[model samples]
Target: MGKSDCSKLHIAMFPWAAYGHFIPFLHLSNKLAQKGHKISFLLPRGVQPKLENLNQFPSLIQFFPLLLPCVDGLPPGAETTSVVPLNQQKYLAFAVDQTRDQVESIFKVIKPDIVMYDFWFWIPDLARQLGIRPITYVVVSSMSAAYNTTMITKETTVEEAMELPPGYPSSTVRFKDEEAPIVLSMARDFGSGLTFYQRINTTFTQSDAIAFRTCREIEGPFLDFVAQGFRKPVLLSGPSFPETKTKQLDDKWVNWLSKFEPGSVVFCSFGSQSELQKDEFHFQELVLGFELCGLPFLVALKPPQGCSTVEEALPEGFEERVKGRGLVYGGWVPQELLLHHPNIGCFVNHCGYGTMWEFLLTDCQIVLIPEIGDQILNTRLMVNELKIGVEVERGKNRQVSKESLSEAIKFVMDKDNETANKLRANRAKLKQTLSNRDVQEKYINSFIQALQDLVKK
Candidate 1:
C-alpha cells in the first residue's frame, strides 16, 4: 500500500443492533466516505429507516440493508435494540448471528478492503476466513474498556475476584463485591456461548487493529493502558461528533423551551437502553430534585414497564403542581437541539457515553446519576478525572435521595462556590477543544492513516 492507496479503501461498517453503537459507526463511515473511500454500511432493514443522516454523506456511502431473521423470543420486525425491551436484547444478538450466512454472502460480493464492526465480536473470525481485514470499533471510553479487559481477560482467584483491578482508582472509586453482580450480568445475557467479556477479549485478539471513540488529549493514560495490555495498534477515532447538519426540531418543543431564561432549565433524560424503574421512591426523589432546585425543567420520560402515562408513573398531583415549571413528555424529543438550547443550564443524565459527548458539546453542567453498565465509570471520569461535573451520592441501595440530587444540581448551576467556578471554567476549556471541528478531523485522518499503514503490513 502506498499514499495513493488511501483513496480507494472500501470499508464495511457493521455495528451492533443498539442505537448507541450504530450512531458512532455511521459518523465514522461518513468521514471515511468524505475522504474518497467507498463505504458499505450493513444493517438490518428495520434500522435503515431510523437513520436520519443516511442521505447526508456522498453517494460513495452505500447502505446494504439485510432482512433480519426472526428468533423465537424476539418480537416480529423488532430488528434494532431500541425497539426490543432491555431484557430481550439477547434475542436480537441471536437474530444477528443467524444472519452470518447472509453477511458472508455480502462480503463475497462487495469484497470490502476492511470490515469495521462493533460488539459482534465473532466478526473478526469471519473476516479472516474471508481474507478481509477486520477492525473493532469500540464505542465506550478507554477507561471503561481497560477496566473491563483487565477484569475479564484472565482467570481470577478468589481474592482477585473480590478486589478492584490493580491499576483502578481505589481511593477515588472502587467496585464492591455486591457490584460484581452488575458486572457479571453483562456477560450472562449474551446470545453467544462465550460471555460478552470473553467476546471483547476475542475481538481484541483477533482484529487487525482496534479503534476507540476517544483521543489522547482526554484519555491518554487509559488508552495507553489498553494499547500495552492488548499489544496491538489502538487507533483513535475521535469523539466522532455527530453531524448536527440536519437539525429537526418540533415546534411544540421549540415553543416550550422559549419561555425559560437562558441557562436556567434542567434537561433530564436517561437514554434509550437504561431500565430506569428501580423503585417508586427513586422516581419520586428524581422529580422532587428538580422541583426542590426551583428550576424550569424538561424531562423526556420513558415510563417503566406497565406504566403507560407519566401521570401514572410519577406521584399523584406531581404533574399538576409542576405544570408551569416543568414539562414531562412521554416520547421522542430532539435531544441534540434541546441540549444546545440557551435555556438548558444543566443536564441531569445517566452518564451514557453518547449522552456524555452531547453534554460536552454545550456549556451545560453535568449532573451524573449513573445507573448501569459503563455509566458509573463515565461518571467518575467526568466528576473525578476531568473535574467537569458533580456526582450525586446514592444511598446503600444505590438510590439517589432528593436532597443529594438538589445539592449536586446547585453545585453546578450556582457557580457561587470556588469549586463550582473552577469546574465551570475547566468545562468551558474542554467544550472548546471537544467541539472543535478541526481537532476531530485530525483524529479521524490519523485513524485512516493508521488503517492505510496496517494494510501495508
Candidate 2:
C-alpha cells in the first residue's frame, strides 16, 4: 500500500490478557491510535472491565473478544493469559496454541495490516499466514528482554544467576540461590523445556520488528546488545505510559494513607498474577512485619483459589490488629493514581515490570521484594545497580521472615538513612534525564516510521 493508503493502517494487538501485558498494550494502542492507526485489541472476554476504563479511546480502537477453548485443566471461561497456573506446563502450552488459533480467526475477520503480539510462540506463523507484519512488544525493560532472549540458557540456570560476576551491572545479576533450580524446573517440566527457547528464536527471526517499552538511555548497553545480535529493526518506545497530567487520588485510600506522616506509608502490591499458596506462612510474616513497623499502608491482596477471601490470606486476627491503620482491597485499585498521591511514601513491591516503571516514573522510594521470574533480576537492579531500593533477605527455604521484612521497610523508610536520600537524589537526576518531551516524541515517531518502513519493504 502507498503512504496515502496507509492513512488508516489497521493494527491488531494481541496482548496476553493479563494486567501487566494488557496495560502496556493499551498505552501503545492509544499512542498508535493518536497517530491515526486503527487498533483492533484482541483479548479474552474477562478483560472487559479493563477495556471499559479505556472507553475514551473508542474512536480509533475496536475490541475483539477471544473465546478461549475449554480445556481439561483450565478453569471454564478463564481468558487472561496470566491465569495459567505456575506449575501447569501442558495447560499453558494448550492455551497458547488455542489462543493462536483464535487470533488467526480474528485476523480473517478484521484483516488488519499488522499483528502486534506479546511474547508468544504462535504469533509469527499466524502473521505470516495472513500476510501481515508481526511485531514483538516487550513490555519490560530492554535489559529484561536481553536476559530472556539472549542470556538465559539451560546450562546457565537461575542458581548461576545468583552469583554476580564482580563489577558487572547489578541489574543484570540474579538473587535467590534457589531461583536457578526453580527456573530450570519450570522451563523443563511445564514449558516445552528448551524447546520454548527454540520457538522464541524462530519467532524473533520471523518477526518484522521488535519493539520495547524502554529507552536506549536507561538500558543502553542491553539495547545495543539486542540490536547488534538480533540484526532486526529494534524500536525503543521508552517509558511509553499514558500521560496523566494531574494526579487523581482515591479519596478513601488518601484518607487511609493520611494517617501516616510524609514518606511513611509503604504501599505493598505484587502484580495481579502473583499467587501465594494457602500454606505459605511467609506472606503472613510480611504482614506481621508491616504491622510491627506501624506504617499506614495499602495492600492489594489476592490469595489462591478457595482462599480468595482477604481474611483467609491474612494471619489470624491480622486485620483486627492492623485495623484503622491499613487498607487492604480485594480486587483492582488504581495503582498509578495511588503512586502519585502525596501521602504515599514508599513501595513494597513484587518488582513486576509495570509496577517498577510506574514507581520509577513517579520517582518514589522503593523496597524491592521480588517473587519470581525476571523479578529477582529487577530487584537487584533497583537495589544494587540503581541504589534507590533495598533488598530483603530470603530465609533458608527462600522465604522472607517477618523480621527481615520489617527491617527492610524500616531501613528504607527511615528518615535518617543517608542511603535513602542519595537514592532519592539519584532518582531525581534520572527523572530529569528522561523528562525530555521532544526526545520521547522522537522515539515514538521513529518507532512508527520503522513499522511503516517494514510495510514498504
Candidate 3:
C-alpha cells in the first residue's frame, strides 16, 4: 500500500484501562499515526495526566475522555486507569460496563472504518451492532493464548486445573496443600479469566482478524498451533515497544542509582495496581530479604489504602538498616527509562506482558515473582520453558520467607553461573531478531492492507 492510500484510513483504538493494557495499545496507536492513519484514542478520564503530553501529535492523533460511574472511596470522576481496591470485583465490573458505554458513544460519532479493542467481551457484539469489523488484540505471549483457550471450559472445574497439564513446566503448579482447592476454585470462578478466554475464542470464531503483539520468531510453536488448529486470520505484529522522543532520566532517581557500581543495582517494581496490605507480614519478609542481600536496589513501594504512612508498610527500622543503599518511591516511575539505564543489572517483576517485552528488548536478566492472573503462567514460561529467569517459592500462607526470598535473589544475581549466562545469551538472540524495523513494518502494513480490502467489500 502506498502512503497516500494509508492516509485515507481511520482507526479507533480502545484498550482496557489498566496500565499494562493501555500502554501497548498506545504504542500501536503511535505506529499507526506514523503510517498516516487518523487515530482516535478513547480512554477513561484518570489516564489524562499520563497522556497529557500526547497532545503534541496534533495532526494525526486525538484523545477522548470517557466518564465512569463513581464509587465511594474512588476519586470523583475516576476513569479506567484509576487505582481502586483490588478486592472490589463488583466495582471493577461496573467500570468495565462504563467503558463499554463510553466506547459505543464515541463510535457512533466517529463512524470509523475499523475498531481495534483490547480483548473485551462487549466489543464483538458492539461491532456487529454498528456494522463495523472488530479486531481483538491479545497482549500476552502466544503460549498464554493457547493455555487459556485449551484449559478453560464450562466442564473444567478449578479442582481439575490444579493438576498440571501434560508437560506443564512447574512442580509448584499445585498450590499449598490446604489452599489448593480454594485457589483452583478462584481460578475457575474468576469472571475476568472466563470472560477473556470467551472473548478471544469468540473473536477468533467471528472477527475479521486477530492481532497479537508477538512475532513468529519468538513464539513459532504456539503461533503455529493456533493457526493450524483454529484456521483464523492471525497477524503477528512485532512487540509494541514504547516510543518516546526523550531519553531524559529522573534526576533524583539517577543520582540515587549513581551511588552503586555499574550493573550492580537491581530494579524492583511490579507494574502499577499490584498492591498488598500494610500489615501483611509477607511484605516485611520481602524487605528483610532485600536487606540481607545487601545489594543496592531501587524499589517502588505503594502503600495500601488506610496505611497512612510508608513506615507502616515496612519492617521497623528497615530504612535505617538499608541506609542510603536503597531508594524507594511512593508512586509511579517511568519504567522503560529505568530499564534502559546502564546501571540496572536485573529486574524483579510481576511479569506483566508489557514489562516482559521491555525486559526482552533491553536484554536484561529477570527474576519473576508473579502475584496473580496470567502472570502465574508467564512466570512458569520464564523459568522452566525459556530458562531466562527464576521464581520465588511461597509457603502455605502465600508468603515467601526471608530465607527463600534471599536465596532466590542470590541465585538470580550470581554472575558466574553457567545457566544464567546461557539465559542471557538466549535473550540477546531474541532481542536481535525483534530489532528489525523493516520486518515489523511489513507485518503492520500487510495487516492494514487487509483492512483496506475489507473496506471495499
Which parts of model 3 have CA positions greater than 4 angstroms off?
Answer: 4-7, 70-76, 98-105, 151-156, 163-204, 228-230, 279-281, 304-306, 453-457
Give a tens-digit lDDT track for model 1, residues 131-220: 789998889887777776654523444345445556653345445454565665655646766566776777777888878988887778
lDDT of 2 by residue, 1-457 (tens): 2346455678888875466778888888888887788899887776866676764478888888776677777666666557666555455556656666677778998898888886565787778888898988878666555554543455655555444443334434554556666555434433334344454555566687888888876667667766666788888777776766565675777677777777667788877776666555455676777888778888876764457576777778888888888766678788788787777888888888888877876656788778766687777767766667788887876778778888888877777889878988887777776676777788878777778777778
Q: Clashing residue pairs, candidate 1?
A: none
Q: Evaluated with lDDT, which candidate comes out highest? A: 1
Tens-digit lDDT track of model 3 for 81-190: 44554444435545665567778888899888887776466677897798777777778776666554444554656556555445433354323344444334334322
How well does candidate 3 score on lDDT at residue 262? 76
- Candidate 2 clashing pairs? 158-180, 159-180
lDDT of 1 at 61: 80
Q: lDDT of each model, Cα atoms only?
A: 0.79, 0.72, 0.69
Question: Which has the greatest TM-score?
Answer: 1
lDDT-wise, the better of 1 and 2 is 1
TM-score of each: 0.93, 0.87, 0.86
Order the candidate numbers by lDDT, best to worst.
1, 2, 3
